[model samples]
Target: MSIADRRRAQGFTQEGFAFAVGVDRRTVGRWETGKSSPQPPQRPRVAEVLQMDLDELDALLTSTGARPKPVRSAPSAYYGSGDPDEMIRREFLRLMALSGVIAAIPDDEAEALEGSGDDFGRMNGHLWQVYQLARTKGSVYPVVQSQLTALNDALREGRAQAGTLCFAAGDLFQLAGELAFDANRYHDAAASYSLAASASKEIGAYDLWSCALIRSAYVDLSERRYRRAADTLGFARRIALRGDGSLATRHWAAAVQAEAFAWLGDFGACEEALDEAEKVASLSGQGSNGRWLRFDGSRLAEERGARYLQLNRLDLAETALKDALTLAPLAAGHSFRRRGAVLVDLAAIGAKRRDSEQVMQYGLEALRLARISGSGYVARRLRAMTVELGNLGRDRHIAELKAEIGTLAA
Candidate 1:
């Protein structure tokens, strides 16, 4: 007999069964209709309500043909299991495939799920907080992966509203993209951002959609694909214009555009974009939730400094980077990464000026922080700085600093 048949034979109405199971009536309806099965935590309670053992409950749940497939083994971590890079990549790929499964279901059937989107919004908000507060970003991967799995099951079983699912998918995909990006998996980051953009567009979420495009542009920017990055940023800028102007989305797009222009060696265009980014200072609110839509002009100093440094404007770069260092938060992991980046830029300036003492002073400190934080972003900056030291005439201190940095990869 089906679950509903057993429940009714036991003289329990759907509402009564749901009440005893501590779930919503709609959730019971979904199980009865073969749309979804009980999660592991809910199984024992469900079995008790239907007067069955664990084995009988499993059989009943499986009879619906809605059981989730067993998880596949992930790729071996080349960097070791404890390495944040490997952990982030493995979790990101696993969740990406799971979350993408929602696209397989037909739209109309998917929309039939009962709950409002508020539950998902709240859960995502909490996850974002945990992400921002974590020491290592990879530490948040397990929770995010779990959330994605739950969302996937809900979407597959037609237990969530379609519009809500789209919004959640867009948000979750962006978060996944960030993890992939931090892990230096640029291709995976680009794919996740593309999925986010698609889902945001489906729901007319202009800000979310534009942010996805902006993030996708970063993948191109990192690879030194300046022209492609510029083109993508241009599209993002136009999309952000249609969003709430009171928000910082447009300015964030412009700020990132400045970086592209800097890389392209267009000093004039770069400055123009920087000026446009400064408009965020005049806005009323902080213009961000410190989560998905972060753009309060706090990073502008560092970004401007980085861009000017790219343009060989050492004086301007130093001044801006100093300001960023002063404003950066104290003793936070994120601050360590940010401060390490600015210090590396300063060290690069010292290298260009052929000042060995200045190079050692800044470079060694940045390298120490990179090792402490395990930040790939900071490590990459230090590697580039090492290449710049070749022009410094083989100074012993510079060589020592390079040797120290080499130990990071080991």
Candidate 2:
């Protein structure tokens, strides 16, 4: 969407949106008409006022054939170039699915590279979406490496939009860390997450920073360091609180915290966190967008089921997992990873009860899904069921299930 289109959709008049961007209404007119582009330092505010990520803002500017050109020669002339509209600084992003959070960018860092920062942000977001959809994660490495190199060079050379570039870099770092996590490279993932958190902190991107911390918690969780994971989640929850209230930043953190708390056997804390996560359903907006915020309560049921399973509450886990299975996202097989995880959980319940038939039924289906989707997450869950499978060995099917899980690829 172009700037005008996005502005109107977000319920902003030219004068109103541009007014918040600290630019003249005439400047917006020129931008939409492809006559002029916002100067570098002003682009961030423009993007924020439009209630969009830097990538989306770039789309609007680039769509109109507008290009940013830093006005280094004159300062007074630029500020007095034209009159802007009267608009409140109340963030429009709350309307953009990110609750009442407004970013406070240094009026200066919005202008760094000509189009590189936006390009990086856009490409990084696209790569994350692609990564989420792809079964095998390794294929995205080449492109990620290339983009990382270019972005790093740009970061060093670019000066004005330091914060913008850093945010884009942070987004890219998270994606890179996700890839490392998928490959089971825990150390590398931690490093990438650290970089992500640092970069995001530079820009005061509460959501982004919190997300990095959440991912870091996953590393500790994978290592069976429950205490460390809980600590990390505790920090993430605090960071998320500083972000836009409309976004699901805090809720997502709560969800993860719920999982961590469950692992710690803190039943009260887990329930409290789960209740907080469920509140996402009451939000007026989706509480997410094309950026890093993907928690919209769509997977809340599955999340609840997983938490219950962690706490060994089989009845609750079974009910919630079954409910999750009936949901469209799982029923239609939109996400094999999620579906497979649920199946594995169900199989674990069956194993706990010494129900061979039930174990074989859900376990086999989960194994099949793992093969079809090549999801390491599902594979890991399937492999974790080995201890449960050890409790039952009278049936040949149980032995086969254990063997298959052992042979699953990393």
Candidate 3:
């Protein structure tokens, strides 16, 4: 059957289907026209709205000759001179609205999950929907933050059940913490993580509790508080050991330990932790849904690259970073942040060699990616690289690069 036919079979008009799937109606028109195709990440939502599995949807599209062309990475040509703060805020609200609908479970059926009641499964799915929505856009923060406050109010008013409401509240707080981390607001991130940990503990959400601790450790790492970071991650690691040995919990603990050891300049311990991390990557199977398993060792590659960068092992650093760049999925919004980081490191190596062309090339790309993602963390790191690049002296291109970096500074 054709893609349109399948949607019609599912009782959705073109506009109705587009609205249901969170996309523009014209984009849907183009899809059905076979003029273009939805991106891979978008396909799952399309299937969900059509009430078909992904494979079946793909088959229908294929049968209708709806082929997707490759989308090449283009340099930022339209970095608008608009207020980024406003843009970020708008995007955040859009994501929150999306999350609200996606995260809602029917009130009647919501009570069945505890003690193998259906409520547990339903709530788990809803929590995961919120998590996935947050992962897609930085703009979801305000909505999540509002939800966190609302959940607390509900608890205070004694208007909600303890089990499901508490779990949902913890999940919302965790997403807020994640958004704070993304914005490079470490103090806010730390506070949100602390609240998430408390809520998770209250709800017996061991996985989420350990994850929150790992997040808190990242804040400590940002402040160069290595010893404190280690303490936080060590506590998480211990808790993870007693909590089902879930792949996500174990991998997160090992990844943070690797990062902590790297900061301490303990290469031996870092490598050992990395080895444990690799074991998690070697799991027999990963569920197809990426909602819960986003931490599958990609950052470990970045950590290795950063460690080598710190040790002045430029050759190893370059190799590791290139490996990280290869493993990072370009369409993943956060991958730009990672690639920008590695590029900055590589640019540093170019500076050491007096290779102005290489430095400009990599540094410019990093700057562009940082601004596009509004990644304050990457933007800060790139600003530091600008200072080192300055000693190169007397090039208009270098001057322009510095200008760009200045705009991104916090």
Candidate 4:
């Protein structure tokens, strides 16, 4: 029988059943119509209200053609035989589904397994290193997806401690959010960050929670929601204060706050925040957790440049961007997305100064990098630079540069 039939058999209307389970009547209607399944936290309450055990409820829920498909194992040759990019995308989606299944199980009922928390922790640490060192950030998505699957499975199967699971989930969610953000999926990124913050708060991981909030603020900042971003950053700063003052979390919050303030045209506040971020260098030990939290002020120069560019301080922007270019890794080993962003900012500076030659030089280089990396982040930045170029008139070189960028964008 379907869930709706079982509910009717038990003499409860949809609204009555929803009231018993403390969910909206629409939620019950959706469950009956196969529009959505009960989430993990709702499963126990749902089973109770239905007067059935978990297994019986599962069967009823699946009886209405709403069951999840059985997960398939990857073929022996899957890793090396398929088109590489397609393989990554397929595996990434599969792993994401696996995480969902794992998340759906209740902690108390999950069977205890033999995996150690340290094992998962170490593996996650290595994945973070791989991501940081990869040429294009997209290359890390598959690995992050896999790690998230494993971590979720471990948690659901009771192989990891509750606190450890929460911490790991928080970190993995942040990394997932980064992938989504770079792909220009702002809504997805915001959702992931919200999940991360929720997980971190469950474990009282102040630094992780604050970092998630700061990352969420970036989505708002990118969308030109300056006041909302500032509010988020301000809340993150307060959370960071409750943690280790010596950690980079507070400083990282300040750095992002600097950008938001610059966007608001609060030059004095921006500079003060930048100064706070710079103090991380004078402190000992870099203040990072080496895995999900690494803010040693390495990106400060580039960030300062971007902030200055936003504030229309072309002279300061040029100097900071030049220093950033020197400090950033070379083309062969560097992050294409990061380098492309700095180059785009330099092009903006050139456009502001009406230096056609400079604009072409930086703009074309950024376009080349964007094409090579296939980064939506770089493409978005290029689109913004195009708007900046509107005032540059009809110079032949500038027109040619814009045409090339348009082609790359297309």
Worst 10 residues of 1 by lDDT: 73-82
* Model 3 misplaced stretches (Cα beyond 4 Å): 1-137, 287-293, 329-334, 390-396
Between candidates 1 and 4, name the one with more favorable TM-score.
1
RMSD of each: 19.1, 21.6, 18.0, 14.7
For 45-86, candidate 4 gives per-residue lDDT tens digits of 467567775556667778886663322233221111113323
lDDT of each: 0.74, 0.71, 0.63, 0.74
Q: Model 2: runs farther than 4 Å from truth?
A: 1-117, 329-333
Instruction: Count backbone clashes in candidate 3.
Output: 8
Candidate ranking under TM-score, highest first, comes to: 1, 2, 4, 3
lDDT of 1 by residue, 64-138 (tens): 665723223333221111233334434534554455535434434333321234677778878888876665665
User: Pairing residues by index, what is the TM-score of model 2?
Assistant: 0.71
What local lDDT does model 4 show for residue 269?
Answer: 94
Superposing every Cα of model 1 onto the true structure, what RMSD results?
A: 19.1
Position 390, candidate 4: lDDT: 72
lDDT per residue for candidate 3 within 1-410, as digits (tens), equals 77888889989898767655546778888888888777753564566467665556667777777885332222111111112322333443343343332233443333242223234334444555665544233555445544554555554454555555545644555665666566554545676677667655655656667777888898888768898998888888787675545456767777777878887988888888778777776665661124333677657777777777766678888888888777775665446667778889888878766688989878988877777777766776776676577567787887777666655524
User: Higher-lDDT candidate among 1 and 3?
Assistant: 1
